[model samples]
Target chain A: MSEDKLLEVKNLRISFPTTRDRIEVVKGISFDLGREKLGIVGESGSGKSLTGRSILKLIRAPGQVTADKLSFKNIDLLAQNEKQMRNIRGTKISMIMQDPKFSLNPVMTIGAQISESLNAHNKLSKSEVNQRVIDMLNDVKINDPERVVKLYPHEVSGGMGQRIMIAMMLIPQPDLLIADEPTSSLDVSVQAQVLNVIDDLISKKGMGLILISHDLVLTSRYCDRILVMKSGEIVEECKASELANAKHPYTRGLLAAIPSLNETRDELPTLNRLQKEPI
Target chain B: MNAIELNELDIFYGDTQITDNISFDIKQGESFALVGESGSGKSTILKAIMGLAPKWNGSIKVNNVARSHGIDYDFAAQCQMVFQDPYGSLHPRKTVDATLSEPLTIHRISDQNERIEQVMQSVGLDLSFRFRYPHQLSGGQRQRVVIARALILEPKILLLDEPTSALDVSVQAEILNLFKKLRKERGLTYLMVTHNLPVVSFLCDRLAVIKAGKLVEVTGVEQLRQGNFKHAYTQELYAASGGVIS
Candidate 1:
């Protein structure tokens, strides 16, 4: 393993026990994360979300997560007990979910929720925590942090809500941040803004980021390295700048399927599922 | 003859105005698009045409025939809608056959089985999956079924509200191809509402950009393909979608 690696995983597998058999979702995927941006691109049911959730042991009962090696900063994650895992969850590592509408606490003020995360991870005075909350909100580019602190989640627009979610997750200053489809729900203009905030904070804080999304162009544009997943496995890994020259057929197919800005084809080329190899 | 004509349209939900003074003309067999972000009243225009938006004052015509405010049976036969979110638009308990057959039953059309099969084939859905429920199909398959349901009535004009937005990129390509084929084969007119500029460039002939309930500009798809949008908001949207401004 590299010395600068923030997180490492080897042969990670996640499964759920059904009545008849155990169905595996993440089928033996492995990767190492440095203090740089990494992107995981896959469609629905490809186990990208499952792989992210497994890092923090967020998978619930009936869903079993097993791995040959899963570690953070040379610490074995599998050996940690529930209490120890809780300590590392937000303080050392955190996750930002896809949609803010469901992730944010609707009943609580945005400021209170952000402060709660800070208080839970560290011991700080009320004023200090409040100050950090406002500062974090401002870091995410929210206008008028003082006024936004009192507003509830429902009062903010979708883009603002997502930024607030980012602020809440980022306030703890985790070593690594896993964001799942962070801006998929926002408008195009707002999506660009939210992504810029995430990009800026990731660079400024020197934090490792795992950006999980299905949009190929978006992931390629934002990440340093890209992992293309299909049927719960990584089909291709490449430098983000060379995604257009990817060698894997799946990656090429996906890129071709998306209608470009200067699309001239009478019909976009679709993936030939019938010819797809068995998982 | 124009396939669809909206003149000085005013749409409202209760007392709140959704859109005002909206006017456009889609010629016969033309594929027109309404491009805007969410809450920009693009979908409301489709709803108003479908009689879903009741509080609307406008003269809407289809094939040179004026549309009344109520649900006109004659108009219903000529126009149909394919909604966004194939997951939510479909009924969980209903089979694909049942869903497709309902429109025929409503219109009291005979030869239901034959029509259903034909429409299913037209949308490129397998006949073997006709009895499957919504949960049994993939996102792309579910969207095909939804398209089949819309086409079962043999409508002349299809009102599509973000038809491919909910599907994956590969699936979206297949669905878009299917739509193109259907329109060409059936000589159908399309009024599509979507925020995806790339999709508009692919599938539409002309597009009208809507912003906050107002039409900003109407231009040819060639302009969008060339990133030649004149309106500032349209340029912003194009740039936001990662289009290189030439």
Candidate 2:
């Protein structure tokens, strides 16, 4: 691993055991992340989300994840026991999902759910935990944190629920964050706000971020580097600004897939999948 | 006469007001779009026109005919809707044939066999997919079936709510092309609701940007052609949705 690198993954392969055979979703792939935002872009079954999940050992029994090297800040994640993994789960590494409704506990109040992370990680008193929850909620730009904290997950809107999820994930002060389609469910207007909040925290904490999304333009905007994946393989890797100038046909195909607002073309360009996308 | 005219419409969900004082007029054979954030009442406006939201105040006139707040049978054949999620919008248990035939049966159209064949051909669905259930089909195929179901009635006006958002980009292009061809061939009028401005640029002649349940800006397709929008909200939204073309 390099001196500045936060996470180093090498020869990482994840598979699911089915009745017939073991299907490999993520082929042996390697990548390095520094204290900067990295994006993984691909189609729905492209294994981008699975890669993110595998880093945290989030993949369950039927799915087996193996890597020659999977380390976070010099800690071997694969070697860690269950109890040790729990300690590292949210405190050192946090993840935010696509939809908040499914991730959030319906029975718990927003404040309790957020403060629960703080309680598990640190020996903070009741008042201190309350203050931390309130502050984190406000940090995400949620108005009226006091009232919002008392409300259940069902009581809030999708955007607000997502903000609460962000707050809960960030409260532990993780050194690394992996967000898988975090704002895919959000409306366009609210998407910027949610991303802005997450970006601001990443900057402030200098935490490494892996933003996994199907949206090429969005990931380019928020991330420092991008990894475009196709069929369980990294097709292209480039700096965020250089994405427009990417040389690979797959990258260009992805860029051309976006319908331009200028309305020059009668139809948006489609990827010629018949011709194999250049590796 | 314009294809659709909503006069100071107020839509409600039980006691809660979804949209207030919404009014618009779409010209015949025109493809108009309602672009807004989630819960901005864009879909509600479509629902109001479809009579799904019966608790709506004000007049909805379609092709010079006023619509009542209930199941208007004659209005049914004149307008149809295609929803966002092809997976959810389609019936899992029903075959493609049954799904397409249900609307015709409801309207008591005797020539079901011919209409079904015509509609499927219009949407470019393969004949082999006629007997398959929704679960057996791909996302794009399911969407095509949904489109076929709507066109089965041979409606003049089609209300499309985020039709391609749920499908892949390549599939989206295919479906979009189908929509364009259908409009030209059928002389169809479209009122689409979507957050994607680029889709609007491709498919719509005009666009109305909604915010907080109110119409904020209505711009020509030429404005999109120029890649310049006057309203700050519209520009902001354009930038947020990947800053495509703009």
Candidate 3:
């Protein structure tokens, strides 16, 4: 627990109970984050998204989460009760889900839904909350925040919907943000646009980010440090600049597997499962 | 003769036009791609070719045979489509064998027994997975089954609608390799619609950049590799994808 360290996770293990056995998906991985971007990269069933969800204590029963030490700013997250966790969720740690079309409320207007997030944590007058909502929308680079506020979630496009999700998540001004596959659902062009907005906002607020993605190149581009996860373990951790020259066999295999912009290979090399040594 | 041809094509979903007058042709054994953002009517164009979009004006010829507005059985045997999401596209209740066999049965093709086994192997699926339902298979495996169904007909052309978008990157590489192998072996024509430019560069010979139902530019993958796109929107799209040619 130092001042620069914004979040600390040690021996964090998440598992599920089956009919005959208990399966550990996240096998005691540890990492520390300052007010900087840290990316977790892995494929499906690799426990990347589970790691993000476990931080907010979002895992329900039958599904289990265990850790030796999970703390945020000298606050013990594992020790918090349900009510105490709620208090820390929005104001301290907010997450942007993979899809905005589902995360947003269909019945409520965009303004009402975003204002609800702010109203839940802060006691503000109606006019003050409305102004803050408009300002937040503008912060995410949404055009015509005035008209957009009046529309429903379905009315806006996917990229705009995701920005609205970002506005709602950051409106509370959390100390940490966990975006799980945030742009995977978006098109390539819109993906960069959304990531740029997040990068801008994170730097301005000086908040820590845990970006979870399956794509190696994307994580390397956005994050200061990249952690390659496989099964339930951290196979390799390195600076984003050094990802291309990474030493781990699995990491090298992943780097090689990504099709380059000017690809000339007759066949892209595929990752061999046997190369993934057991943890 | 062209494998597929569209001249002055206009598609509408009940009075609201989805795609404007569009024209493109894929040569025999050629790999062509349609690149665009979602809701830009790229998939709609595929649907119109597959006869899924019925209210299309203008001629669509497959192997020089003109297509009618309704479902064409003869056209189905000549061309096949592989959809984006494998989970949603396949029948949840049907076994892999049943799904693959239905197409052969529909075409009244003989040697059903060997055709099923041959296609499964060509797509790199193990024999053990032939009896499993869609839920029992992984995303990559299910997509292989979808591609197997497309190939089982021995069709000259395949319409792939964002085939590997749902899978992980490594799985995507495997599938892309599969596509290359199939194309090389069968000498098949591919009309793939994808938003990933790098994938388009790797798999397609020529690509059509579509924006808001209008064709922007049709250029070769060579221009894409050099990052020298002529059109402004195509340049913007390439810029978004990180224009690193080296």
Best by DockQ: 1
Residue A218 accuracy (lDDT) in model 2: 84
Error of 1 at B6 (Å): 1.2
| lDDT, candidate 2, B126-170, per-residue tens | 677789898887788889899999888789999999999887666
Q: Could you give the TM-score of chain B for each candidate, in order?
A: 0.98, 0.96, 0.98
Tens digit per residue, CA lDDT, model 3, B5-121: 999999999999988889999999999999999998999999988888999898899899888887888888889999999999999999999999998888888899899989999
Model 1 per-residue lDDT tens digits across residues A1-279: 388899999999999988989999999999999999999998888999999999999998889999999999999998998999999998899999998999999999999999998988789999999899989988999999999999999999999999999999999999999999998888788989999999999999999999999999999999999999998999999999999999999999999999987778998898766411134
Error of 3 at A1 (Å): 8.6
Q: List where candidate 2 sits over 4 angstroms from the true fold.
A: A272-279, B110-118, B242-246
Q: What is every candidate's C-alpha DockQ against the true complex, given to 2 decimals?
A: 0.61, 0.49, 0.59
Best by TM-score: 3
Off by over 4 Å in 1: A274-279
lDDT of 1 by residue, B163-243 (tens): 988888999999999999999999999999998889998899999999999999999999998999889999999999999
* Model 1 residue B207 distance off true place after TM-score fit, in angstroms: 0.7
DockQ of 1: 0.61
TM-score of 1: 0.97
Error of 2 at B42 (Å): 1.3
Indicate the fraction of true inter-chain contacts that candidate 2 also forms: 0.53
lDDT of 2 at A58: 88
